[model samples]
Target: MTAISETSAQMALRDPDVRVMLRVRADEPGAFAELVGQYQHRLVAVMHHLIGDATEAEDLAQEAFLRVYRARKKYRPRSKFSTWLFTIANNLARNSLRSRQRKPVTPFVSSESGSMGPHEQMVKDNRSGPMQKVQRKELADLIQEALAALNERQRVAVVLNKFEDMNYAEIAEVMGLTTKGVKSLLSRARMNLRAALAGYVYMDGAPAPEEESERPV
Candidate 1:
């Protein structure tokens, strides 16, 4: 009887799709497509939050896949297959942001009228209310502004933590940071979000009450 190795790569092999990715590495038929089918939506979602444009997010997600395909020969899974995949995503999103900074635009225009963008998705997922009464797109715009107030690194970390539901250690692996560094980054990001959204409607879509003293002025 042979003992199993519990290393990340070995553990990752347990995921059927990761095994497909391994076959992709070996140039097997349809394996790459299988891997892409599994992660395309997720990758695009993360890219949308990071870059704030749906069209661009789709492009970047495709680019990430291309890069992964190209790097297949060198693929060595030191972490979960998704972790490795997102590390590639993280780099592409940051690069896109930096490129965008060279030529500033007004803002991202939603590619469609009715579909929810990344910020709206976050707001709806993180908070709940009788949203039918409010303009969802406008509320999403407000949240997007709050997200914009954070610097690039904070924004990226926040998206990964919140939207991706990744823990600090996992985020560290993705972002190439220590666990403590991730903690500090997320802490500052949350504080900035609070300050930015203060006195506005809360995430749950309720009005924020004003604080006042009974003594009066």
Candidate 2:
């Protein structure tokens, strides 16, 4: 085998998801469904964060899966399966956002009903009374707004880093950026999110004092 194929083989050996995808490539029954079941919620959540519309996010997620299925025959284990999947999702999100820019419509207003991000979990763990529930809902709304305020690339980087828990190298692979570029991108995203959420809450779900200015402006 060629050196690249050897590397691919090594990667496939290292990642079980890649092996599953290889099964998909081989037309193994149920492999594609297994892949979808494993990733559907995550893919949809990432898409929702990217696009800001739950329905559109579902559509994009489905499209991403469709593309993955159609391109299974060309699958190569050059990177982690999740990274490759999100790369496709990122492309679709960018295209959808660009199209929306050309023909603006009323923005979709989605509640944080089914969200299970860090902040949501924090709130869930702390829910003690109706007042706390109200606070949790407000915090969730503020967080969503803060996320929406970020520019597209920054939002993508932040979502991949914070939500997906992807390391810099993985994010770089998914985003088609150098590692340094991913670092810089995440730095800017952090600054933007801090600025957007200043005096409200920290990214770690800690409440920020009204007078706190420790976070970079």
Candidate 3:
């Protein structure tokens, strides 16, 4: 994104969160805490779902907020606060994947220790029974395997499009690519997702029974 004029920046920053950002820009005491209160959970959720690593997701979410704090003085609200927020998150996720290449692929499931850590146990307990938990774990494993199959750029594009609800233009801006390039990336991503979720009813874009009444305009 290019720099904006001061007047335009001020105008755009009129968003309520941007006002809180202005406090951060001014280096107000405890402003960072306020910002964290506002965005931390959201950033963590975005990172976790995008990268599929809960531990690293927390780390990356912290780094994204730190970036926001460090750059606060120069912060211009040309985009929605969320767009800028996720742009930082997406960049960190890419870097994390690069570092991960040095290590082996590890599914989030626990090994033969026959024990789950606190987090794993909590999620496992929510599933219906032993059979359902195992099925859910298997499905999760398959999804991760499919995500691993994507090239980095395509993966980022898919995450932004599917999870973040970013349109082509915002995704292109975040990934630093052209609109046409983003279109191509999403096309490839859809193909990969189709392959990954072949039997899933979601691929057909049908809303589930509970959600049909809440359809968007």
Best by TM-score: 2
Better of 1 and 3 by TM-score: 1
Off by over 4 Å in 2: 1-5, 108-134, 202-217
Candidate 1 regions with alpha-carbon error over 4 angstroms? 1-6, 109-134, 201-217
In the range 89-197, model 3's lDDT, one tens digit per residue, is 9989988887887888765443532454433543454353433344555556556556656788987887778777889988998989999999998898879776555
In the range 1-217, model 2's lDDT, one tens digit per residue, is 6897788668766998998999999999999999999999999999999898988999999999999999999988887899999999999999999999899764443445445543454445455432335465666666686788688998899999988999998898888899999999989989987765554544355545643666567
Q: For each candidate in the order shown, give its overall lDDT on alpha carbons.
A: 0.79, 0.82, 0.74
C-alpha lDDT of residue 175 in model 2: 84
| TM-score on alpha carbons, each prediction | 0.78, 0.79, 0.71
lDDT of 2 at 188: 91
Clash pairs for candidate 3: none
Minimum summed lDDT over a 10-residue window in model 1 is located at: 207-216
- What is candidate 3's local distance difference test score? 0.74
Error of 3 at 167 (Å): 1.7
Number of the candidate with higher lDDT, 2 or 3: 2
**lDDT: which is higher, 1 or 2?**
2
